[model samples]
Target: MTEDQSALKTLSEVVRDRRLQLGLSTRALAQRCIDPGTGKAIPRHYIQRLEDDLANLAPPRLPELSALAAGLELPLAVIQEAAGFQFHGVTTRHSESGRARMFVARFDELDPAEQDRVLAMLEAYTAVKPPKVD
Candidate 1:
């Protein structure tokens, strides 16, 4: 396979790994995409093709990726990374201290309303730092 195809295969593997880690069957995941207005389920075959890497679904369309991320309760960035795309703005530091400080600073940089929304989201999804004791 060409490099691009290999990369796509790796990305597909990542998606499959994440899906399995989340314990979602292809059919179950498709059901999560049910259209609210129509109440029609997304076809299971579409999901199966995606998981099997049999379809050209790598670099999945944004709306579908967003739905899968929501259904998996995963951060969009994590999903994007799994899909072989890196988010540009988020910084990654080598040291844990630097990482923590950067995270806090990034957290602070948001507007107050956005900060509240982000904090609420973080609380709902993953563990956050407790207030410093000392």
Candidate 2:
């Protein structure tokens, strides 16, 4: 596969991983996308296609992303990261143990719950911590 295709694959994997982590089935996520104002829903098959990487839906509109993040009860940054597009100024580092360490070294982008989840996962997976000094 070409570099772009490889990147897209990585992006797709990220989304799938995060979606699973959030405990959302594709159909449930699709239902969450219903347009409140118009009472219309984006089709479940379309969502399945997107998650399965059979189709690359374009970057979601702001409102759509917002509603999705809200429904998933996750920060937009988390969704965006899973979607493989980081917002400006977010940096990520991977520890020696292979745990992803994200540094929002700019703004306090993630809410407390998201932070807790991330930290808990990191601790569970890698037991990461600063080395003790003499």
Candidate 3:
């Protein structure tokens, strides 16, 4: 297991706090979000439910997750990480700190062709690893 890379918060708090930080009303947040997969605007009522009672709600699917990330103006990885830990009750070793971590977190945003190239690069690079410098 990896050390915590960020402070823990429930998905509700993550969304609510970020929304407030952006000075967005719940409706405004919802208005700004659309399911990336469907290209449909997310309902304001759904946003309200998420902020008000996320614990009782099923974890959002991938498209909604993308929408929330856009809405919150956070990387999709941050939202995914929070949701994964909070709802799935598990965390990932792949989730790391610093630039490398951010690279992996945003990796999913890449297209499949790009992902293949990245994976190839990762494998080639890691095949000749040097020790980290302090």
Best by TM-score: 3
- The candidate, 2 or 3, that scores higher on lDDT is 3
What are the per-residue Cα lDDT tens digits for candidate 3 across 70-108? 888888888887888778866645534477776887689
After superposing candidate 1 on the true structure, give the runs of residues whose Cα lies further than 4 Å from its correct spot: 1-11, 33-42, 85-134
For each candidate, give its TM-score against the true structure. 0.46, 0.43, 0.76
* Candidate 3 stretches greater than 4 Å from native: 1-6, 92-97, 123-134
Candidate 1 has an lDDT of 0.58
Q: What is the C-alpha RMSD of each candidate to the true structure, in Å?
A: 9.9, 9.9, 3.9
Candidate 2 lDDT at 74 equals 61
Candidate 2 lDDT, tens digit per residue, 1-134? 44434343233465466568879887777777654445556667766666666543665554555545555666655555545542232334446664334354212356678888877887886876668799
Candidate order by decreasing lDDT: 3, 1, 2
Candidate 1 pairs with clashing backbones: none
Q: Which residue runs of candidate 2 sit more than 4 Å off their true CA positions?
A: 1-11, 34-41, 84-134
Worst 10 residues of 1 by lDDT: 85-94
Per TM-score, what order, best first? 3, 1, 2
